[model samples]
Target chain A: MNNAVLLQSVRFIVLVLLQVTLLNTINLSQYINPYLYILFIITFPISDKDNRLLFIFLSFLLGLSVDLFSDSGGAHAAASVLIGYLRKPYMRFSFGVSYQQQGQKIAQSPFSQRLIYISLMILTHHLTLFFIESFSFANMMYVIQKTLLSSILTLVLILFSISMFKKKQ
Target chain B: MRQIIIFIVRNKNFLLFLLLFCFSLGITIHSHIFHRSTFINSANFISGGVYGTVTNISDYFSLKTYNNRLIDENIRLREELLKNGISEIDSTVTSSTDSTTNYVLHRAEVYKNSYKAPKNYLLINKGSHQGIKEDMGVITSGGIIGIVENTSANYAVVQSVLNTNSQINASLKNTNHFGTLSWNEKKDYRKVQLTDIPKQANIKIGDTIITGGMSSIFPKGILVGTVEKFTFNQSGNAYIIDVKLNNDMTNVGYVYIIENKDKNEIEQLLETTENE
Candidate 1:
C-alpha cells in the first residue's frame, strides 16, 4: 500500500533470489563464500515505532528460506533471529541512544559508526552460524578459521555494495 | 489476570525470540543425526523445483564439458569391450557376474550441489517415483558422489562425501586393506581422509582407492580416489590417509544412483547376526 512496505517486500524477494541462485553458487573458495543476503537484515530501515518483534519474525523467515534452499536445517534461522533480536541494542550501542531521536538513518551515519555496526553484526552472525552448523567442539579451531575468513569476505562485499548503492542514490 | 497480561505485553518480543530460537536449535540438532530424516532440506517440492528450474538454464553453459566427459566415458567403455573380445554383432550382453548382476543404475540430474559447508548435501531430480530410496550410492562416470540420505516423491537429498558426517567403506584398489573414508572440517572438497588402514599394507602416494563394498550401499571396486598422502594416526597401530578424490565435487551434474538389489537382504541378515 505504501512505499516502505513495497520496498521491503521487493527487497525480501530479490535478496532471497540472489542468495539461492547466484551468491550461493559462487564457490570463490571454500573459506571465502560471501553471505550477502544478511545485507537485508543489516540495512532494514529504522523507524520511530518499536517494531523489533516484527523484524525478528521476518528475519526468521528470511533465514528459514535460505536453509530450505541450502539444506542447512535451521542454523541460518537461529543466527538471523539472534542478530535480529540484538539489532536494536546494537544500533543503540554503535550510534548512541539519541539515534532514535535523530531518526536513525544508517546511511546518514558516520563512516566509522556504520563500519562498527556492520562488522560487529556480520561477525556475530557468522560465528553463531558456523558454530551451529559445525556443532562440534572438536573442530573449534577449524570452525573459527572458517568463521573469520567468511566474515571478512561478507564484510567487504556488504560494505562495497552499500557504498555503491549510496552513491547511486 | 490484568497484571499478568501487562507483564506479558511488556516482554512479548523477548519471549517470542526465545521460543523461536529454541525451536530452530531443536531442528538443527535433529538434522545432525545421521539416519533420521528432518523436516528442513532441499529435497522437498518447493526447493527442489526452484533448483531444477535454475539448473535447467545453467546446464547449457556447462554442456561442452559434460559432452567431453561423456565422450571420454564412451571411449573407455569401447576399450573395455574390445579387451573382453566382444563383437557388436554378438547381441548378447556381457555375462553377468555376482559383483555386477545385483546392482542396477538409475540416472539423475543434480539440481543442486554444495561443497562449501562442513555438512554438505546434494539435491537430485530422481526420487521414490523413480525407484530411488535412502542409502543408495550416487556416482558420476568419473567417481563417487554421495549416498542418498532421504527421498521425496520427486527429489532426493544426498549426503556428499565432502560432508563431515559422511563415512563410507573404502580400501586400496590393489589390496583389501579396508578403512573408513571420511571428511574433516580442515580439508577442502577435493580431499577426504581414510582412517583405520592397517600398518602392514604397502602404501604410496597416488595409490588408487575404491569402495570396499563391505557396506550394502556401494558395490566393491567403484573408483573413489588416490592416496594424496598419509601418516600414522595417534597410537601408531594404523594409518591415517589423505585421499585426493577423483571427482571435482563442485562441478557435478548428471549422476548415476546405484541401487544394490540385495541391500535389504544383507541388512536383515546382519541384523539377525547381531541379535543372535
Candidate 2:
C-alpha cells in the first residue's frame, strides 16, 4: 500500500531468488560460500514503533524460502530468526540513542556505524548457521574458518549491494 | 488474571521469538532423526527440480570435458574387447559367472553432488523404476563412487564414500589382505582412508586398491584407489593407509550402478544360515 512496504517486498523476493539460484551455486571453495540473502535482515528498517513479531516472522519466511531451494532443512530459518531476534539490540548498540531518537534508517547512518552493524549481523548469522548445520565441535577450527570466510564474503556483498541500490537518504 | 495479562503483553516479543526458534530447531532435529521426514522430502523435491534445471543449462558448458572422458572410456573398453575377443566376453555375458557377468550395470548421470560436507550425498537421475535399489554399488569408469541409499520414483540419493559413515570392503590389488574403506572427513576431495589391513600384509606406496568381493554390494576387482601413504596404527596390529581415489568425487558426471543379480537369494541364504 505504501512506497516503503512495496520496495521492501520487492527486495525480499529479489534477494531470495539471487541467493538460491546464483549465490548458493557459487562454490568458490568449500568454506567460502557467500550467503547474500542475509542482506534482507541486515538492512531491515528498525525503529521503536516497528513490530518485532512481524520482523522475526518475515525473517523466518525469508529463510525457509532459501532453505527450501537449497535443501538445507531448517538451518537457514533458525539462523535467520536468531539474527532477527538480536537485530534490535545490535542496532541499539551500534547506532546509539541519538540515531534511534532521530528515527534514522541504518542505511542513513555513518559509514563506521553501518560497517559495525552489518559485520556483526553477518558474523552472528554465519556462526549460528554453520554451527547448527555441523551440530558438533569436533571440527571447531574448520567451523570457525568457514564462519569467518563466509561472513567476510557476505559483508562485502551486502555493502556492494547497498552502495549500488540504496539512494542517499 | 490482570497480572498475567500484563506480563504476557510485556514479554510477548521474546516469547514469540522463543516459540519460533524452537519450532525451527524441532524441524532440524526431526529431519536429522528420521532422515526422510516430510520437511526434507518436500525440500528435496523442490531443490532437486531446481538443480536439475540449472544443471541442464550448465551441463552444456562442460560437454567437451564429459565427451573427452567418455571417449577415453570407450577406447579402453574397445581395447579390452579386442584383447579378450568378442566370444569370450559374450560367453561371460550369457553365463552367470563370478567374472563381470554376474552383475548388470545401469548408466546414470550425477544430477547433484556434494563433497564438502561431512555427510555428503549424491543425487542421481535413476531410481527404482530403472531397477536401482538400496545398497547397489555405484561407480564411474575411473573408480568407485558411492552406494544408493534412498530412491524416489525417478531419482536416487547416494551416500558417497566421502561421508563419515561410509564403509566399503576394499583390498590391495597385489595381495589377499583386505580392509574397510572410509573417509577421514578431511577437506580434500581426492583422498579417502583404508583401515584394518593386517600389519603383516606387505603394502607399498602406489599399490592399487579394489573391491574385495566379500560383500553383495560391489563385485571383485573394481578399481577404487591407490595407496598414497600407509602407517601402523597405535595398536601396532593394523595399518591405516591413505588412498587417493581414482574417481574425482567432486567432478563426477557419469556413473554406473552395479546390480548383483543374485543379491536377494544370497542375502536370504545367509539369513537362514544365521538362524540355524
Expressed as tens digits, the lDDT of each residue in A1-169 for candidate 1 is: 4998999999988888888888888978888778898999999985648667888899898999999999898999999998988888888899888888888467778999999999889989999999998888888887788889999989998988787778433
The C-alpha stretches of model 2 lying farther than 4 A from their native spots are: A2-10, B1-8, B36-38, B41-44
TM for candidate 1 is 0.95
Residue lDDT tens for model 2, A50-83: 7788998999888888766544557889999889
Interface RMSD (one decimal) of model 1: 0.9
Listed in order, the DockQ scores are 0.80, 0.51
Q: Cα deviation in Å at residue B223, candidate 1?
A: 0.4
Chain A TM-score across all models, in listed order? 0.94, 0.94
Model 2 — TM-score against the truth? 0.89
* Model number 2 iRMSD: 2.3
lDDT winner: 1
lDDT of 2 by residue, B116-213 (tens): 66666788888788888989999998989989877877878888898776899999999879999998664466898999999989998999999999
Q: Grade the docking of candidate 1.
A: high
